[model samples]
Target: MNVRPTLEEIRRAPKVLLHDHLDGGVRPGTVADLARESGYPDLPTTDADNLREWFEAAADSGSLERYLETFSHTVGVMQSVEALTRVAYECAEDLANDGIVYAEVRYAPEQHLRDGLSLEQVVEAVLDGFERGGREFGIRVGTLVTAMRHQARSMEIAELAVRYRDAGVVGFDIAGAEAGYPPTRHLDAFEYLQRENAHFTIHAGEGFGLPSIWQAIQWCGADRLGHGVRIIDDIKVDGDRARLGRLADYVRDKRIPLEMCPTSNVQTGAAKSIAEHPIGLLRRLSFRVTVNTDNRLMSGTSLSEEFAKLVEVFGYGWDDLQWFTVNAMKSAFAPFTDRLELINGVIKPGFAQLKWSGTRPLA
Candidate 1:
C-alpha cells in the first residue's frame, strides 16, 4: 500500500525520462556564458534568473509553433564544440541531481550548424559531453539525433543516427512544428532506419491531431510517440466506462509508449489543464503512458517536478509513480539488459524504500 509520495521522497526516487530536449534544457547561466563566448547577441537577457523567467514566459504561448520559437535563443548560444559539450554535460548533471537515473535527451544536428560545425562534429561534441557527465554524475544518458521536420534532411540525419548507433547516440527523431511536416514526409528516412535496424521515436500528436499520430506509427513506424496526448481524441468516454476507437485500440494493443509531458502539453494548449490532461484517462486505460519533461528550462520542471504535479493533480501514489517510471524504462532506447538492470536494481528498490519506509499495524 504505497501512499502518495512527498516531493522530497519523489526527488530521491529513481526516474526515467524519454522526451526531454537537449537545447530546451540548457542552464540559464550557461546560456548567458555561451552566448558571450560565442558572440551571439540574440539572448533576451544575460542575467541567468531573468533569462530563466523569459524562457518560461515566452514558451507559455498556447501554440506549439510559438512555443518552439523559444528554442532559437538556447540553440543560438550552443554552436561550437565546447559550447555543445558543456551544455550536454550540464544537462546530464541536472538530470542526475533531480534523480533521473536514465534519460534520452534529443537535439537537432541541423540546428547547430550555423557556426560551421558538421553534423558528425556536432554529434561528437554532444556525445563527449554526455559520456563525461554520465561518468561524473553516476547517471546513464543517451542521445537522440533529431532532424527538423520542416527541413529535407531526415534521411541524412537518419544515416547519422545509424553511423553512430553503437556510440552514445541511441536513436533518431524529427522535431519542430508537426502541422505541415507530418512524419510521412520523411518516409524514406524511417524506412532507412528500419533497414538499419535502428530505434527511433517521432514527435507526433503534441501540436497536431490523431491523424498526425496515425501517420507516425502506421506510416513512419516510430518505436514511440512523443507527446501523444492527442490520442485521447480517438477515445470516447461515457460515465465511468470508456470505449477506445480503432486507432486507440491499436495503439494500446501494440503497447506503443506515449511520452506524455503534462506541463508542456498544457503550455502548448495540447491539454487544457494538468488536472484534465489525457494522461489520467490514458493511464487508467493502460495505454503504455509514460511521464516526461519535454523541456525542463521552458517548463520550469524536472522529472521529479513532473511526478509531483501528477501526484498533486491525479492523486498518484508511489505505486503509480513506480509504474510510470517502469513504463519509461521499458520504453527506453537503451539495451534490454540495461533497462532491466535499472528497473530491478534501481527504480524498484528506490520506490520501495520511499513507500515502505516503516512498519506498523494498520487499523
Candidate 2:
C-alpha cells in the first residue's frame, strides 16, 4: 500500500504552476475592493467569504455556460489599467505565498478592453504589475496572452501575443467553451503563432473529449494541454496494466505536457472527484503531467492544497510532488537558462531540505 504524506510535509515541497488564469485566481476581497473602486455594483455577494462561495458554487454548477458567468463578475471590475495592475500584482504575491517557484498566468486581453483599454496598454500594465510583484515577493512569473475560443479575434490576439513576446508575454493560448468552438476553428491563429515561432498551450478535453485533445495537439500544434485530464480516456486499462492509443503514444513519446488541475477538474465536472482523477495513473505512465490550481478562489485551493489533495487521494509523497514540480518547470515556456536557474536555485534547495528531514523517499 502507498503511504500518504502529512500536510506539513507536502506544504514544504516545491511547486510549479504552468496553467493558471489571472482573472480566475483573483482574491474575492480584491474583487470586492476593485468593484468598489470601479463603482460596479452588481456582484452576487458583497462580503469576501460569501463572494468566494458564490463563485465556487457558480463554477461547480456542471454547466460550462454558468461556470463562465463567474468570470464576467471578476473581469467586470478589472476594467481600468489600475485595477488590472493591482489584480495582477496580487496574483503574483499570492502565488509566491503558495510556494510556487515559477508560474505562467494567462488572461484574455480582449476581455479587459471593455473600458477603452487598448490591447497594448493592457499587456503593458499587466507586465508592469507582475514585474513589481516579482521584485517584492521574489518569484518568477510570466504571462500567456489568451484568446477566447468562441470569439473571432483569436488571430488578432495571437499576433498581439507574438508582438509582445519579448515584453513579458511568454506564449499564447485559446480558452473558453471547448466543445463547439474547437481549436480547429482557430487554425489561422495557431498557424500564425507557429510561423512566428511562438509557443502555445490549448484548453482541451476539459468539457469535451479525445477529439478536442487530438485536434489541439495534432491539428493545432500545441506544446501543452490545459486541463487535459481527458487524455486518460484514450488509454485502455487492464487490471494493473494499461495500453495507449496512437494519440496518447505520440503525446507521451514527445513529452507534451498535460496541465492537470485536480480540484478545478472535480468542481468543473471534468473529474467526478479528487480520488477519481487520472493524475496518478498518468504520472506512473510517464506522461509529462504537472499539477496546478486552475482557480484558487473558485476551487478554494492553493498549490499546497492541491499537493495535499493528491497525497490524500493518491498517497503521493515528497518525491511524487517533486517530480510534478520538475515536470511543470520543464513544461514552462520560460527560456532554458531561466528554467535551469529556477530548478537549481529554488526547487533543488527546497526539496533538499525536505529530503534531509529523513522522510522515506518514494520507491
Candidate 3:
C-alpha cells in the first residue's frame, strides 16, 4: 500500500530555508514582551493569542500593501539592540526546533535604527544572537541584510552587507511594495554587490510582474528571486504539455531559485489557495524551487507546516521533500563547501533515515 509521511517524520527530515524574514517571524509572546519593554503604545492587543490572531487577520486582507502594514508593530518593538539580538536568537532557536538545519533569515538594518543604534551595532547584535542560538541548538543560521526599495539607502545597505560578508551576514536584498518602487531603482546596490563579488537576492514578481523579475536578474543580477511567485503569469500549462515564456525559460534554464512561500502567498493574494499555488507546477517542471516561510508570525507557518501542506495538497512524498530541501541548500548564500557539506552530511542522510523507517502513516 502507498502511504504518506507523517508530520513527525516531516519534522525530523532536515530542511533548509532560504527566504525568511526576521522581523516578520517574531513570536507573539515575544512581540508583546518587547512592546512592553520598549513602552511601545501602538500594539492592538497585549494578550499573546489575540496579538497572533490580529497579525494573521491583518495579513489576510488580500492586498500586499495591507499585508505589509503588519510589520510596523514588529519593526517598532525591534528598535533596540537588545530587542534585535533576542529576536535573532529566538528566530534561530525556533527554526532549529522546527527541523530547519540551515536558514538565511533577513531583516532591514535601517528600520531598526530608529532608536539610535548604528548599522554596525544592529548587524553585530543580530549576529551575536544567531551565533548563540546556533551553538545552543546545533543549527546553522545566516543573516541577509535587506534594504527597503522605496527608500534611498540600498547602496548603503549593500555596502553594509559586503562589510559584514565575512562576519555573520551572508547576502544583500531589497524588499518593499513592488509597484511604484521598482527594483531598477536599486541598481546601484546590486551593481555594488556584483563589483564586490557579494551575494544578493531581490523581492521581485511577488507584488509586481515579469519586468520586476527581469530587472532583478538581467539588469541587477540577483542570486535568487525572493517570492518569485508571479513567474506563473508568464507560463501557460496545457494538460501534459506546458509552455514557458522567454522570462520563464531564462529563469528555468539558469536554475534561478524561486523562494516560494505558499501560505504567505495565499495570505497576500499572490496565489488563490494552497492547491492552486504555482509551486507544484514549478517543482514538476524542475525549476530550482525552494519552499520558505516568508513570515512565520504573520502567516502562522513553519518549515514543517509548509512541507506538510504541500504533502497534503500535492501528494508530495519523502523524495519530493528532499529535492526541495537540497535545492534550497544548494541555493543558499553560504559558501559552496558549507552547502555541500550539509547536503551530503546532514540533509540527505536525515531524509534517507525517514524514508527507511516509514512506519507512521501520513496524517
Candidate 4:
C-alpha cells in the first residue's frame, strides 16, 4: 500500500503551480506596510494579524461585495511601481520557500493605473521583481498578464502580453465576475491572442455554469479554464462509472487543463466542502486537472496545503501528488523542452526521494 504522506513531507515535494494571482497572494504584513507607507488608509486594521483574520473571515462571509472589497484594499495599496515590484518579488520568494519549483503568477495591469504608472511601467516593475526574486530564491517564475473581463481593455492587454512575450510574460488571461460579463465579451482579445499564437486562460464556471465554460473554450479559445468547478455539472456518475456529456468529453479529449482551487471554491460556495469537491470525481475520470492556490491570502492556503487537504480527504499518497504535479507541469504555458526538463530533472527525482523516505520507516 502507498503510505499517505504527511503535510510536512508533502511540503518537501516539488510542485508546479499554474494558476496563482499576484495581488491575491500578498503577505498581510506587506499589505499593512504598503498601506502605511502609501497613506492608503482604507484597511480595516493596519495590524497585520487583524487584517489577516479579517480577510479570512470575509471570504467565508458569503457576500460577493465583501469578498471583492478585500481586493480593493490590496489593489489600493499597490498603486506605485515600488509596491507592485515588492509584492511580485515577495510572491516569488514565498512560493519558492514553499517548495514550488515553477510557478506562473498573474495580475491585471489596468487595476494599477491609479498612481500614474503606465501599463508598460506596471509590467516592467513586476517582471523585474520576479527576475530578482527567482534568481535569489532558486525558483523559475513566469508571468501571465490578466485583463478584467468586464472592461473593454482586453485587446490592449492582449497586445501588452504579446509585446512582453519574451521578457518573462509567458501568457495572458481574462478574469472577473462570470455573471453578467461572459468570456465571449472579450472574444476579440482572445481571437487576437490566438492569431498571435499567444497562450491564454479564461475565468469560467466558478460563479456561473456550463455556458460560460462552453464559450470560454469554444468561443474564446482558452488554453485552460480558471475555476472550472462547474464542469462537474456535465458529468453524471453511477456508483462506479461516470458518463461525460459532449462538452465534458471535448474538454477531456482535448486535454484542456482545469485549474481547481478547493478551499477558495468552498469559501465562495462553489463546492460545499473539500471532501465534496468535484476534484475527486474529475481525478478519477482522468480529466486534466491541476491544483492551484487561486488566492493564497484569501483562501489561507498554499500549493502544499491544497495537496495536504486532498490527502486528508481522499487518502492520496505521494504517487497521487506526483500525478497532479506532472499534470500541472505538462499543462504549463512554458515551452515543451523546459517543461520536460523539470519533469524529468526536478519533479520526478524529488517525488522518488519523498516516496522512498515516506515509506522507509515502515519497511
Please report, as a residue range, the 10-residue window in candidate 4 with the lowest summed lDDT.
354-363
lDDT of 3 at 74: 98
**How well is each residue in 56-146 modelled by candidate 3, as lDDT tens digits?**
9999887899999999999999999899989999998999999999999999999998889999999999999999999999889999999
Model 1 lDDT at residue 263: 94
Clashing pairs in 1: none
Q: Which stretches of candidate 4 lie over 4 Å from their true place?
A: 63-65, 360-363
Whole-model lDDT values for every prediction: 0.93, 0.88, 0.93, 0.91
What are the TM-scores, per candidate, against the unseen true structure?
0.98, 0.96, 0.98, 0.98
lDDT of 1 by residue, 1-363 (tens): 557777887889999999999999999999999989888988989999999999999999888888998999999888899999999999999999999999999999999999799999999999999999999999999999999999999999999999998988999999889888889999999999999999999999998999999999999899999998899999999999999999999999999999999999999999999999999999999989999999999999988999999998988888899999999999999999999999999999988888888343222
Model 1 Cα shift for residue 340 (angstroms):
1.1
Write one digit per residue (lDDT tens) for candidate 2, span 89-184.
Answer: 999999988777788999999999988999999999999999999889978899999999999999999999989989889999999988788999
lDDT tens digits, residues 100-192, model 4?
999999999999999899999999999999999999999999999999987899999999999999999999998888889999888888888
Superposition error at 74 for model 3 (Å): 0.7
Cα shift from native, residue 48, model 1 (Å): 0.8
lDDT of 2 at 142: 92
Candidate 1 TM-score, true structure as reference = 0.98
